[model samples]
Target: MKRQLVEELKSRMKLLQEREKSHTAELSHLEHKVKVLTEEASNRRALVDSLKRRLAVASREKSQQEAACLGLRQDLEKKSQRVEALQARVSASERSQSQLEQTATRQLEGLAQQSSLALDALQGRLTQQSSLALDALQGRLGLATKQLEQLTSFTKALASEVLVEVQEVRSELCRKRKRKRLEEVGDVGLKKSSVSRAQAVAASILNMTPTDLLHMLDTPPDTEEASTEDSRRDQEWLEQVMAILQQQIPAAGRLMEAVRVKMKERKVLTEELAALTAPVSEKA
Candidate 1:
């Protein structure tokens, strides 16, 4: 019995030793799993710290961008106000320029009116001067015509008086002839004195003595001393000279008529000159 008990105790001791070794191996495997888990948790914590630093930098950049946008808006508003002020100044300058142009136009119109008035007045004065000159010339022409008529009448009367004087001389010569035999010795003296009084009268009237007046109204010759053919011939010659002088009166009348014709032509020219000037004077 002792031997069997001893063998059973030995077998139980061997089995317990085998169990102890298997349990020790399972404990070493659990320790290796805990080390791998610890390393994984430490790597996750490092990645989260890097993500937080990147988020802080992004927030600061966003705030700076917002401040730049506000400054740009304020600058735009100031530029708009300056533009409005410039537009108002331009409107005021345009109004002043318009008023200056209107004033200049009015002054120019007044100056033109004054110049026109001065020109009209000058024309009127020129027309008046022309009219006055024409009237004075007409009056002078009328006076000349009247003088010419008076001279013509005086010449005709003088011609008649010369004829009467010649007839008286002839009659006186006939009477002296009839009384020759009845009178005494004064005949030669009378013949010498025949032209003396007539020459003096002719010098006074004609400013020169004329042969035609030599036989007119001499003192009667003593008929007995002066009766001769030479005396008769001399008396006939004087009568012929008187007749020639009478003929000259007609020639002087013809000269006067020709002068009148020239005066009429001059008058017609003056009238034509006046006609040419009439319209200008009236317009003025």
Candidate 2:
């Protein structure tokens, strides 16, 4: 009975030792599981902090973009207003330019019309004056021709009378020269008489008026005795010469007056032509 009891006790001790070993192994496995769970929780917490930082950065960026959009919109509105103002100013300038051009054109046309009328009037006056001047010249020329013919006839008559008187005097002088020696009655007396007659005739012609010469020519030759026939013929010839000289004076004066009037008209025409051309040059 003692041996059996000892065997049973040993068996029971061995069974208790096996149970303790199994419990120790189970405890070690549970501790390893706890360490792995703690490490996974720490990694999850770091991931959540990184996600929060990324979200905050995205919100700040969104706000900045909105502020930039508002400023761009304000700039666009200001630019549009400036464009409209400039367009209005341009339209006003174009209208004013058009009005000024129209006004200038009308004024130029009016000036042209006035100048044309003035030129036409001046041309008509010039033509009328020229015709009247030409008629006056023709009348004066006819009168001069008639006067010249009368002078020619008077000269011829005077020449014939002088010839007749000179022949008579020469015959008387020849007869006296035959009777008396030429040296005894020196040529001094002959010279003195000839000089006296010539001087007296010249003086009479120079002193006579135009009317006196004409009257003398119209009247018949004076009948003189043999002693005074030579003197009377000389006086008649001088009167004819004096009448011719007086008639020419008035003709020369008329011609000079006509030339002066023509010069005045030419000057006026030149001034008018310059006035007409001045505007044309300025426009060019």
Candidate 3:
């Protein structure tokens, strides 16, 4: 029985040693699995950190993009306001130009009317003065014709009947009277007919208006030089006024052209801005 007991104890000790070895092997396997799990977790954590970094960079870029977009938007708004102001200025300038044109037209019309009326009055006065002088000349011519007829009759009678000295004295007296009458008639005749007759003849010969000849007669040594010079001066003044008006018109046109160029530039800027922001807007 003691031998049997010792044999059983030996077998149990061998079994216990085998169980201990198995438990040690199982524990080593479990530790290897834990190490593998730790390594995988560390790798996953590193990957997550990398992804977070990427996300942070993307977010920062997005923020910068948003800021840039905001600046662009502000610039666009400013440009839009500027464009509107320019448009308003253009409209105001156009209106002012229109008003100025209307005012100038009215002034020109008024000047023309005044000139016409003044010219008509001057023409009427000249006509009346010419008629009066012509009538006086005609009367003198009639009296001279009568005196010539009487002298001729008296000379014929005296040649036949009077003494030589007496007839010479009578003839000298007749000659003196004739000279005085001629001087009176000649002076009046030249004054009345010189300008009109010369102008009429010149107009007929040159195929021009008598009024143009009349204006030509307005120079030095002509009958109406003083009045014509005044008229010429008036015409020059009117021309200067017209020139001033025309100059102002061109200035307004130039202003309008400048505005048009500015508008074109604004349109170009707007198109470029739209192009620049198109992608941003699409992303938004």
Candidate 4:
């Protein structure tokens, strides 16, 4: 019985040894599986981190684009405002130009009328001068006729004086001849002194020539009076001409002054219109 008991113990020991070897193999396989699972988990975490980085970059780009769009919109608003202001200015300038053109046209028409009136006045003055000249010519012709009549009267007076002197000289010569003949025939006693006196009287009568008497008749009776009459007529004519010239000079001066004043007013108006129409600033 002691030998049988020893053989059973040896069998049990061998079975126990086999079971321990199998358990060691199973534990090694389980440890290998756990290491593979840990490697997979690390890979999934890396993928998640890469996705988050991509999302951050995309959000930043979108924000920048939105800011740029807002700035562009603001610039457009400012430009629109400037354009509106320019349009208002343009409309106002057009209206001013129309009014200025109308006013200039009216002023030009008025100036033309004034020029025509001034020309008519000058024509009237010229007509008056022409009439006065005609009257003066007629008066000169009448004065010439009166001077001719005075000359005729003087000529008749001179002819009468010449005839009387010739008659007296002829009578003296006839007396002298008769006395000489008596002396030569010895019909009467003729004194030498009386004969000499009669010859002297005859010679004196012959010396009295017609030209001297005519020169004496031609001398004017009132030389100073005639000169004074001529001076008075000349003064009167000069005074009339001076009066006409003085009146015309003042009229012409006034006309020029009016033209200058009108021109100055037009210039000021034009300057004001230009300033009002000019742009305040450049358009965008």
> How many steric overlaps does candidate 1 have?
2
Would you estimate the TM-scores of all the predictions?
Answer: 0.24, 0.26, 0.30, 0.24
**Which candidate would rank higher by TM-score, 1 or 3?**
3
Write one digit per residue (lDDT tens) for candidate 2, span 1-284: 98998999888888877877787777777777777777777777787878788778878887888788888888889988988998898899889989988998999899999999999999999999999999999999999899887965675465455445454544444344332332333444767466446556765878975445534433335422533764564555455444544564435444344434434534554555555446547756
Two-way lDDT contest, 3 vs 4, winner: 3
lDDT (tens digit, per residue) of candidate 4 on 1-284: 97888888878887877877777777777777777777777777777777788778878888888898888899899989999999999999999999999999999999999999999999999899989998999999899877766754553344334333433443344344344444453446667677556556655676754444433333345644754764564455434433433452334454344435434544654554444334322211
Among the numbered candidates, top TM-score falls to 3
lDDT tens digits by residue: candidate 3, 61-172: 9999999999999999999999999999999999999999999999999999999999999999999999999999999999987876675456434422322333344334
Candidate 1 lDDT at 40 equals 71
What is the C-alpha lDDT profile of model 1 across 6-40, one tens digit per residue?
A: 89988888788787777777777777777777777
Scanning candidate 4 in windows of ten residues, the lowest lDDT window is: 275-284
| Error at 205, model 3, angstroms | 99
What's the lDDT of the predicted structure labeled candidate 3? Answer: 0.67
lDDT winner between candidates 2 and 3: 3
- Ranked by lDDT, the better of candidates 1 and 4 is 4
| Structure candidate 4, residue pairs in collision | none
The clash count of every prediction, one per candidate, is: 2, 0, 0, 0
Q: Which run of 10 residues does model 3 get worst, by summed lDDT? A: 158-167
**Which residue runs does candidate 2 get wrong by more than 4 Å?**
1-26, 80-284
Badly placed stretches (over 4 Å) of model 1 are 1-123, 181-284
